[model samples]
Target chain A: MNLAFTEIQETIRMVQMESLDIRTVTMGISLRDCIDSDFDSMNNKVYEKITSYAGQLRPVAEQVEKEYGIPIINKRISITPVAELLGHASKDQAVQLAKTLDKAARDLGVDFIGGYSALVHKGITKGDQTLLEALPEALSVTERVCASVSVATTRTGINMDAVKQMGEIIKEASELTKDANGIACAKLVVFCNPVEDNPFMAGAFHGTGEGEAVINVGVSGPGVVLNALKRHSDADLGEISEVIKRTVFKITRAGEMIGRVVAERLSLPFGIMDLSLAPTNAMNDSVAEILEEIGLERVGTHGTIAALALMNDAVKKGGAMASSYVGGLSGAFIPVSEDNGMIKGIEDGALSLSKLEAMTCVCSVGLDMIALTGDASASSLSGLIADEMAIGMINKKTTAVRVIPVPGKSEGEMVEFGGLLGRAPVMGVNPFSSEKLINRGGRIPAPLQALIN
Target chain B: MEQKRAVVSVVGKDQIGIIAKVTTCLSENKMNVLDISQTILQDFFTMMMIVDVSEAEDLAKLHDDLDKVSQELGLKIDIQLEDIFQTMHRI
Candidate 1:
């Protein structure tokens, strides 16, 4: 037979029975040329460039989806960090540029436009400060603009000053959008060692080193992995890892193919395929469920981290074998709100903030899509970020924090951000203050790992 | 020129004329069925057809026509380009 019947059936089962999908086709457009001292002209250029480049993104993605019969969930755009273009601009100008980005995203029919961002790991420049100051207001005012701030890296250690300010900025962002349960904070991410070409938001952005325009794809298949593991339920961990690796290889291959098609249609350069098992709120599509299927009683139990480490490593190994360009946080994503199983784990008293933090040490992204008490102190938030950042710094891996302090909501209360963003139960934060430690406001010097060079 | 191939998958409860109706739609759309397989597992019908759609004027229209037949027969149908299956499942 030219095509094996079983193979065709298996592919159909993966897409139809399981919820395998291409999570996003993100176009990263460089806005470095949009820079101007005149904020208005710069904003116009940014909008024009994004609209021109990404105008056909949705139609092309839809056509590809129809042709391939694979669900392409989101068509998004990421740009050069807005801060880089705000060198001589004021805080108000930064906010205006953010609005321009929001308008561009809407015009292009994309779900989100990231890169309202600043990389302040070493120290904050004047432009970085302005962007940081405008983050809370910009996020609150815009619907589709996503923001990220890089506050730590392996080469240059954590910037405690920016970390401290980020705590306040997060609080302000939450309070400003308190009526909607601080949904704005859900669109913001704080990262240590942010990748240059992540296709996922709220961390996607075209980095300084990327080309003029590039198309990156993110593939999601926690359900596919879970289904694969189910077939080998009695297998040992080594064999289980093998199953995961094989499954990831297939998923990554599909993503790379779709990415090539999309980039070719758009006449842009293909960047990378991010092979992440990103879960949705849909049932049976949870990373936590995959962990549970690996013989854990629940997601946050004793063997959870080890199981996640196995899966993450196996995914990367398989993805590396499948695609030459595997960038972004290419492993299992454990976003609390976005995964139904994680929410169940939290509701069952099996998962806690500390436990999730520990799991982040082994997973792709860190402390993502978690919600905190409305009254959680800024010091505690900063301390939590500092801890996650330290893990990334010491281990030299990417880690991020996207905790939303949903105003007027207490621990165990539900805060719904509607479709895709999902609903998160406000998890409790440490009551004690870390003000003294956070207020030190100096760079946490690079760890010994930095000496590898 | 090489024929443009597609996979037409139909799934539903087992019933008579499932294959006949699907092939009629494909023929009306000027698609030639290259390979076909059907199975009945405990009264559930599942079939896969590798069809050459090069002569079909509009692939999307053919898809919609097949979908309309699938709905009338109370079945789920999907028409996917062959490349998706080959690229993903093959090395």
Candidate 2:
């Protein structure tokens, strides 16, 4: 046999038992050519372009899954930012475009379609202002249209005006969808230094620099890494990192192969493969569980950041070598609601909002899928977003906030958004005021490059 | 014709006609078995076969036929292209 029996069995065990699977295969379609001065004409062009480009995305992904025997969890589409297409368009026109996108998603049978976005890190343009104004209505009215806004970058510092507006927008989105536990907020992300080719949502978007269309893959398997760590329980931290690297290398190889084949079948250029360890509500498949397997009593205890820093670096090192093109937020994700172990950590009081903030400084994206009390002030939300943005700006990494303030829900209460969005316990926020700081609506100066400390 | 191969794996209890039933289905579908290995590990039977299905008329139907045989024999049978294993294990 060309392959050893043990090697074959190891692959089987990883898939059948450890919840190893390709997280998503997202097709990035460029809608720049769909723009027109007339709003309805632009909406029709956008709809036709996306539907035509991604018509075979689901069927092709399913065929590849069958051939490879690996489960591809999601087949999604992302497009150019809607702000780019909203030339002299009204807020109602922005909402109309979102509805068009939602209809396309339903017709194509994709669960979520991202890139209803605006980029205003330095200053908001007229189109961006219109899109931001339409966010609450557009998000609440659509079923599968995901939206995002970039309010900060390493070079641009933080746009305090956009940040403050997004806080109010999130609140209105949740309030409008109170019947569904604020599901509208679950589909919105506020970002700082967001990536261009991210295949994960509600953060994924096709950057302006990308080609006409491309296929990007996100590989997930925290459960596989957890099992590998358990098998080498007695190893030192250095040895433990080696174990993680090797396991990540194998999984990345599998993911790249699947992605390339999918792209080849569609006759589109293959984009980057995201080497992120995204967790789900499944038991033993949690990134927090991987931390616990690394000898943490719990995920948010002291020394958690150190352990996470080590693990995140090792994952990048391994995945970088495995795939030629790697992009997206390719780090360990610790969404509070998405990972079952994280939910347990929150319930047991082992994890707090503050600790999660600290952990994001050393890991992947920031404050993902968190739930806050209904009465949490918009200024506080803006403050939380600013703090996260500062970290990403200073460190030159991508970070984002996707929080849901479930209306009429208090701290310690739970709300369910179901399936992938998962359920979250409404946690209390700091009861201080950031109204004065948010009221000073000007750009925070970009940091200096000479600071070594 | 280009050569395309698949890995067919069967895992279950050691039972009568396990090999006979599996190979018969492959032959009926014109899939040639290039290499095979079977072992009893901890009182359970595990089998791995590398098959060339490039000449098969309908691959999906062959998969369905093998699925039926697996159900009758009370085992788990999965067929995946050999490229998946080669991509992971080799490079």
Candidate 3:
């Protein structure tokens, strides 16, 4: 394989100088076959299957990192939604299963294990309700377990009942881990139109449609893209889009190659390469900075949405051109805490909760990693989620809410969740109450556009 | 047959004996250097080498050995499999 000198140098600079990394290599393992009538037996089978499939994940990822000289940031596992395997299990059994998952993740030396999830887009089944009941305890008691609830989709519309329930669930999860600054909420995501093969955490799950086992890779290069844009600082929007598309093409190609190699080594089918410009707590590694580099003085100021739309479209265009199997939330992420520029924007008073919500209309994920006031009511949370869900449901895109109501923390106070989760300022919510609207708990019927089929 | 290749890159302040030490380490590890290039740009040294490591028994050990040279020479060193470069830069 002949290569150009400039290409080699650029690759080296991207990895060494910039924080170019394969964010995650997640193995999605189906737990449908692990189900048994007896909860204890089912728990053991789930553990065994997960450990057997993911035991090699960490070592293999580390080996690849060494050989490739690119950082493979995380090795994770996403199982089939535990609710599907629960059948008629009790809340206690659900918590036990979550413990089992946490233990399996620890034993395998992985960072996080997702899919303590339920898909109740239309309505909740008995099993789904049971899992929801156990979510707060499951997430609080376990270290590595992450959970998500899908409450809306384009085809099924918004499940307002489930939305209301998730609001209370988020509050309970936060209060259960209040001493840790509501960190449990960081692991729980409420989604509309969630992807099955997403390797990113807080929302990743092995959907029912996936095979027995598969490997999905997420590549992150916000810093690399920011550096690329710095070179074209004086260029117009059209020229800037070209630079971004070219950069994303290279990044997605690298992700596909690495995903194929990792899958081959594990003897698992390669699923997809999620070319999301996932940011981190590190300086300069921010999606918000990419927006700022695209002519915004600040991330949430005027022209922010236009800039985000351009970036999101160009990323998908370039990523789709690079790999045939481009899936997951392959767009720009604007999570509040995970992005340094966003944190700065909030601190500088240039960003606000409303502005963040508006920005979600253009970005990949919606209202992520934000911290709300402790006094914010569950009704308000549901209202916020409903608005975000409507955006996704109407547009046929994936949107999620992972906001934390930090207990006893008011607006202007900071909740520090160290490491990749980062810290968030407790942004003020709308003082106006939405309790009446949220209490009208019923399904918002599928939109007119959903009748396309 | 799959081509067994690796990219070894070095960068730092211009220093003497950097390439000599790097190639000597590669040769000792049973890696055949297929191509090598280096340049001094504005008082900084940069070099890239493509090596065939088919006979090398342990890539991890080779990487560690190169790390030792990097530490001693006060340079940034990276050794990656060739497929990463090819896949990202080429069609």
Candidate 4:
């Protein structure tokens, strides 16, 4: 039966059963002109603009959820990367700017304010350099701010220097905040290809090419898809793909409807509908489980690569067919602690860092839920990040590293951050590193062959 | 000797004993499962069974028996005779 496509949420098969709804309705506000000689006034302007426009976001999202029986996951805001906002400012002033963002996000009730990002695929600008320097202090002081840096790309083989530097910076960020699995570092994303309209947290930012205002959506439903798959236990490959396509169509519809509403309500341009099956720490709702169901014994096994590629391709196909404009890194997620299956796989010797990297070549995000020992040296952690960065730079896909260096923990130990943060059993990492190799911090120019097919 | 193959596509809500019932039907009819794979499609259970039935006692009766099994198990069954199953997606 052709399900009548009405609301975007309904299109995505969103059955709002519990009190849970789509958590947030993020407003992407541009902070290009918020620069000032005095930091206080400028920060205040930035806060006022976000608070005033986005104050209505929660109420509207709730109203939509209530009216349509769909749950909106988050109500958030993305600004021009904080560095651009503080372009004309100094180092200390940048930290103060980050502080201002923290207070405003806390007061406004937005879970996280993204756009503390820098695009340095080719080279770092002056503002980007300043932002990079202030990261340790800015991240340390801020509670609700998120940051991202794109250091490499397919066109640009790898920014060995930036990748090496960020490895140190991330470890430093973790050192200051030991608890919550380095919650501050959790907010940082290292991108090879960062998109403009990703409505997800920690990476969402207003791109330079965007209009005055535009609405992008992040639709997630790993739980729903997994549940559906469970009920279709005997479907063949073709039949299974059909089922997935149908399910994703419903999920994509949900996003499209929500995005259309938010755009219309705020009088902003509606951007593309991003159909990523973003997984969380929920039980029975994991991308890894999907692989397991498809005959892979474990998530990080030899067969795991093919399994992930199949699922990722299938999900994108289904979601893309559902929505007119499907964008962003739409694929499966394989965070160790986030997906119970992945965690179990990691614990059971079914998954490994190398396998996870292979999977990330096809799936969404990279080196995520990778919890290193607090004793993991700065250069060692950098080596790990470099490996992941290498994947994205080669594949030409958007990849992010959310490495949590759990303090005072050894390998095989469990680290619990409670709800959503989930429980993670620490995995082992290579102690040895290429400090000599990584320390040679210069732009690794793009490979000429990368331009070819 | 004559060679017979069937493309068996199973689709419906997942229930217990699907594989047992379907495989039993094939086995009783002297059909050897050439290859079989299953996965869930949303809330539905789907499977494709490639069976070589050259040695079957009765082709028509086997089809009828499998149809009965399909009805009893609440599954949608499509049977494609040997030629197509051999040609499509053979690895």
Per-residue CA lDDT of candidate 2, range B1-91, in tens? 8879998999998999998999999999999999899999899899999899899888778879988999999998888898999989896
Give the candidates in order of DockQ, highest first.
3, 2, 1, 4
Candidate 1, residues A1-453, lDDT tens digits: the string is 267888888888999989999999999999888878787888889888999988999999999999898999999999998888898898988888888888888877899999999999999999999999999999999999999999999999999999999999999999999999998999899999999999999999999999999999999999999999999988999999999999999989988999999999989989999999999988799999999999889889899999999999999999999999999889989999999999999999998899999999999989999999999999999999999999999989999999999988989899899999999988989988899999988999999889886
Q: What is candidate 3's CA lDDT for residue A390?
A: 98
In model 2 chain A, the worst 10-residue window by lDDT is: A444-453
Better of 2 and 4 by DockQ: 2
lDDT, model 2: 0.92
The residue-by-residue lDDT of candidate 3 on B1-91, one tens digit each, is 5559998988898877998999999999999999989888678898999999888999988989999999999998889999899888878
Cα lDDT of all candidates, in order? 0.92, 0.92, 0.93, 0.72
Sorted by lDDT, highest first, which candidate order results? 3, 1, 2, 4
Residue-by-residue lDDT tens digits, candidate 4, A1-453: 111112212222334321223434567888777777677889889878777767766666665554343567677778887767666778887888788778878887777788888888778878888888888778878878888888888787677777877887888888778765666677788887778877776778877777666667777777777766777889887777777777776666656777777778877777777777666776566778877786677777778887677777888997777677886566666777667888888789877777787778888777776777788777777677677777777676778787878778889898875655577888767877678778877877666647786
What is the overall TM-score of model 1 with all chains considered together?
A: 0.98
**Candidate 3 local lDDT, residue A82:** 89
Report the lDDT tens digits of candidate 2 across residue range A1-453: 399888888888899889999999999999998888888888899989999999999999998998888999999999999888897999998999999999999999987899999999999999999999999999999999999999999888999999999999999999999999889998999999999999999988899999999999999999999999999989999999999999999999999999999999999999999989999999898999899889989878888888899899889988998998999888898899998888888888999999999988988899999999999999999999999999999989888999999899999998898888889889999999999999999999888941445
Steric clash pairs (candidate 1) = none
In Å, residue A359's CA in model 4 sits off its true spot by 0.8
> What count of clashes does model 1 give?
0
Steric overlap count per candidate: 0, 0, 0, 34
